[model samples]
Every structure is written in C-alpha cells, then in structure tokens.
Target: MSRLRTPTHPTYCRVVRASAWYDLVVTAGFATPWTYVLVHDVLSSGGLALGFEALPELDTWQVLFANLMGSVVVVWAVLRIVRPLPEHGLFDGIARTLFATWQAYALAHGASGLLWLFFGIEVAFGVLQLVPWRWGRNAGSVTNDASPTDGRSDASTYWK
Candidate 1:
C-alpha cells in the first residue's frame, strides 16, 4: 500500500509540474511580444524629437533584447511561483519598479502628451505585471534587491 501511494505521489507531482511549465511557457510567449511592442513604442515616440532620436533606434534593439530577457525571466518566475523555489520576490519588485520609472521618465521627457499617455499605460502594465499572484511575485519585483551580486540571477535559472 505504501509503495503504491509513493508512486502515485511522484506521478501527481510530475503532472502538476508539467502543467505549471506549460502555463508559464504560454504566458511568457504571450507577454514577450507585447512587452517588446510597449517599450519600443514608448521609446520611439518619446525619443523621436530630441538629441535622443538617435537613441530610439538603439533603444528599439534594446527593447527587443529586453523583451527576450523578460520572457526568459517570466518563465523562470512562473516556475518559481509554481514550485516555490528560491524566493526572488525582492529582485522581481525592483525590476518592475525600474520599468515603471523608465516609463515615467519617458512620459516626462517626451515631446508630446500622447507619448506621455503611452508611457503612462506602459508604466501601469509594468506595475501590474509585478503584482504578486498565486504563481509567485511578478518577474519585475526581483529588481528591488540592494545586493547587486545577489540580484543578478539569470532569468533562465528558474526553468532549470
């Protein structure tokens, strides 16, 4: 009887783990493109009229790269949330805050109010993404940690 129960437990755990991984993959894939667009749009619009205009082209690439990084982070975060692996709440928080701050800065510096509105929405979404849910803290929150070395966990480590 104990042997049967033990086998069942691991099987159940495997199923649960697989489902969690599937969900995270789906979520990260969905969020990645959206975040890329959001950041790209804000930077393009906000940086279009200044000495920063040249910067937006660079920022476009950066946004793409950042989105990729973010997607990886999101996957790891989902896993951590599902499995309760090493706690990354503090770090995720900081990331979200930095995203928000960047959006706000873009809004403030942009040439047009419309750009500001766009940045504002990005800021809001960035904040929402960081909100703690059943899956664990949002990936952005990991940025809040003061220890730079400890804060630098590879976004993909959680998947392993």
Candidate 2:
C-alpha cells in the first residue's frame, strides 16, 4: 500500500494554527447557544432570529437539536485550540462554506443585513483554511517540506 503524504513545512504549521484559531474564535463567538440566546432575546429586531426572520419559535425538538449541535460545536472549537491539525483545515473549509451558504440563503430570503457580515467572515476564514499558506510571501522565502522533517508523523499531527 502507498503512504499518504501531507504538508510538514513550518509554513504549513503556521497555517494550521492560524486556521484552527479562526475556527475556535468564530465558533465560540457565534456558534454557542448562549450567544444565540443573547442575540435572539436582546439584539434581534424585525422578527429576525439567527439571521432568519422567517423562522418561527423553535419547538421542543428544534431546541434540543440546537443544543446538541452547539454542544458538539463548542467541543470542536476547544479541540482546535488544543490541537492544531493541518488536515482538519479541509474540513474547516467545508464547514465554513456550508455556513456561508446558509447565511447567503438567509440573505436572499430577506433576513437581515447583518448576515452579510457573517458571510464575509465565513468566506474569508474558509479561504484561509483551504489555501493552507502564510499571509505574505517573497521569492527568497523557503520552507522545509521534506518527509517527517519535524520528527512528527502525519498521523500524529491529525485528529489526535
């Protein structure tokens, strides 16, 4: 069987940490149920809730679903903060894309202007994670992408 290779450069390490932090901050700031409650009860106007004005009051199952999702999401953010994995960047990109899509849908349905701001943030983070690169670059810059350069196995770098 062939072995799968992934990025091992210090530049890649930087991207991993940066993307993970983005995920952690964004998830904690917006994905938590407490934040939802605050926005729904205090900040919300024009019948808007979670970027959707058309959504009615959540029922029993809906509330349970939200709680369950939030619980897992908080865990995910904490894990990202604790362990920065380059491979998870792909999944984070997918997650951000999905979120941006939903926000875009809400905007299309006349939800709120605030949703656009969220969409922008999501898109930006998604791009950063997907790209897996540093912010700036010069021709002289070089990174060691050689196999096991840091004495850490690829498997150990991810999902541990």
Candidate 3:
C-alpha cells in the first residue's frame, strides 16, 4: 500500500471490484439463457419454470423485448467488471434496491419461489453497495499535504 491516508479505505475498492466481477458472472449466466428461454421453455421438465408462463401466449413480441433487455444488462455488467467505478455505486445500489422491491411485489402476487431468492440477493447487494458508498471513507483528502493557497499543512478537498 502507498500509505496514502484517504477517507475511503483501500480495501473497499477491491471489494467493489470483486462485486462487479460477481455481477458480470451472474449477468452472463442470465444472458446465455436469454434466447433459449425466449424461444423455448427449457426448464419446464426440470421441475422449474422461469419468467411469465402466460407471456408466450399473451404476446410473443413481449418475450423478444425482454430478451433484448437482458442483452443490455449483460453489456452493462461487462462494463462494470472491466472498469469498476465507486462513484457510480450509489446509483447502482438504488437500482438494485428498486429491483428487489419489485421482485418482492411479484412474489406477493404469487410469482415463483426463485424470485424470493433473487429478492434476498438483490437486497443484500443493494445494502453492500450503498453502505460503503455512504458510510465509508470519502476520497481525495490529504492530511499531510499543505495547500499552496492557504499555506496550511492539513488540507482537504473532498469530492462526493
């Protein structure tokens, strides 16, 4: 470690990077099934079914639209994994929390049990990202450096 004392701990960045990689894996798994699930009910024989059962019959176009959306998520996950940005954590956390709430709502409306597990995970992820973003150390503060303008050793320029 460089021994630069910043508000955000050094380890926090690693954790965020790891989380981004996890997200990448998860999204890839989901994206891999997008076309297959959109066209065929592959899990019907394995005692499991995902997505809306009535969706296929109700509107074929809707399934295609959902598949396209999944592709977008996959791309975003790849970007996050390749270049983790802690500054964007709060927005991502808020989005995950919203998704979890929606999943809970779906479960309440008699959705599948798998969504329950996803809801828990989404909520946990949201908390993990949000907590560090809000309560962890702030970045870009120097305790040892002096400001040229003020001629003081204890100088801090904080950015959120």
* Best by the lDDT measure: 2
TM-score of each: 0.33, 0.60, 0.61
Candidate 3 yields a Cα-based lDDT of 0.54
List, residue by residue over 1-160, the lDDT tens digit for candidate 2. 2223444545555565676666555445345556656544543463455554444464556555656656666677666566656655657777888988988887888765756766898898788776653433434323324426554545443432
Write down the lDDT of every candidate, Cα atoms only.
Answer: 0.45, 0.59, 0.54
Candidate 1 lDDT tens digits, 1-160: 1110011122333333443454355345435666566555655565665434423443456656766766776676576456532233324434546755776677567644444544454344334333432332344333322224554433333443
User: Which residue pairs overlap in candidate 2's backbone?
Assistant: none
Order the numbered candidates by TM-score, best leading.
3, 2, 1
Candidate 3's C-alpha runs over 4 A off are 1-7, 29-34, 38-59, 135-160
Better of 1 and 2 by TM-score: 2
Clashing pairs in 3: 7-137, 8-137
Give the per-residue Cα lDDT of candidate 1 at 35.
55
Q: After superposition, how far is residue 73 of candidate 1 from its true place, in Å?
A: 2.9
Decoy 3 TM-score against native: 0.61
What is the lDDT for 86 in model 1? 25
